[model samples]
Target: MPFDEPSQIPRPPRRVAPDDRPVADRLADIRARIDKAATIARRAPAAVTLIAVSKTHPAAAIEPLLTAGQRDFGENRVAEAQEKWPALRERFPDTRLHLIGQLQSNKARDAVALADAIHAVDRSSLVTALSRAMEQEDRRPDCFLQVNIGDEPQKGGCALPDLPALLAEARGADLPVAGLMCLPPAGLEAAPYFALLAKIARDHGLVGLSMGMSDDYETAVTLGATHVRVGSALFGARA
Candidate 1:
């Protein structure tokens, strides 16, 4: 039997599902909060870049946000990013991927390939590893030197006093030291830490500053953060 001609082919009507709470509603709520935060900081809303941290959340959860026009997403673990990036890239090619976790030297190549920016380059060895990896891959991802502004030994960042020298070395290596990144101590106000980071970046002529997470992003913006990493607030608590 001959198949039906193109003009005679039958088509099924598209089915549209309804939800009590639209995705835009959630995004509106988030945008409102971000607006309030920006206003409180006296910062132009456009100055603060919100990076939707999507670590541990499945791609399905993120698909809605992507559909809602959120283009920046951050992940903490290299292994998780390595696993998630390929599929997410296929699905959302325009989405920007950021590595906001401590990066080990061994994972440098994969991180360079998958991340649009690495927000956690803490030490010279890691930078060297990244430089070598980028050379091998013939790629260079934007990088932020994580600074231990709180001076917390437990944190994975370079000490504050060590920053200038590190920045010089990173620049010398021909790596793009995009800016500074930091994690303030728990229960501590983030403004001072953010201010300090901004000053350091200015002194070195670096422009990018990746600071603040969900808890202290407003404070960070007030202190001149160009980028803020927000996770749980954007995507419900991650297990």
Candidate 2:
């Protein structure tokens, strides 16, 4: 479900109930987990940001979480986000959007226009394109250099050897290089990969680590993940 493969875009799994109460409670539980994980790691809970990945969910399914005081939301497809977020943003002006999916260089302008942060800037071409768009449009979204930490060929990260250069390029372009992101190979022990990403960020003197998803976010928190993207655990199974 990595962002680069659009043909394999994840389909929504199942419909969640219309009731808002569960959504409120669900967020509270997630917040508790985040707090516990942060405490165990001896880091302040407020240091980590939880981004509800509302990829395939419509605005109705998303609003309850917003009402629960979840301000940061993430989306995979720019087009899908375009369809849903404008109305929602009109209603909730403080909502911050993160592009937690792979991005194409061609869509740089739109991505720059829509996202508060882009968590998938892994290549030089994208850095150049995004820099131009941001300059022309007067928008500079925070950028994360997605690393193929597991060295998976199909993933959208800049390979390990290329990360430093890419980071340097992103900085050179004046794109706000905020952090490093990765998708450790699914079903494997994720801690090592998460640890590796944190180390890379440290080696590069970067402050953010956008690792973890629904399954292993707590483990990631232990290893210093600044942002964890959760969808199913907060919203229920996709339809």
- Candidate with top lDDT is 2
For model 2, residues 128-173, the per-residue Cα lDDT tens digits are: 9999999878988898999988778888899888887888888888
Clashing pairs in 1: none
**C-alpha root-mean-square deviation, each candidate:** 16.8, 6.1
lDDT tens readout by residue for model 1, 1-239: 11111122222342223334665575666566667777887877786678989999888888888889888889999898777778878878998999999988999998988888999998999989999999998888899999887778899998877877788889999998889998877665566677778887887898888998766776677778889897766675555
Model 2 bad stretches (over 4 Å): 1-21
Candidate 2 has its poorest 10 consecutive residues by lDDT at 1-10
- TM-score between model 1 and native: 0.86
Per TM-score, the best of the predicted structures is: 2
Clashes of each: 0, 6
At residue 14, candidate 1 shows an lDDT of 24
Name the runs in model 1 displaced over 4 angstroms: 1-23, 35-43
Clashing pairs in model 2? 12-238, 12-239, 13-238, 13-239, 14-238, 14-239
Candidate 2, lDDT over the whole model: 0.88
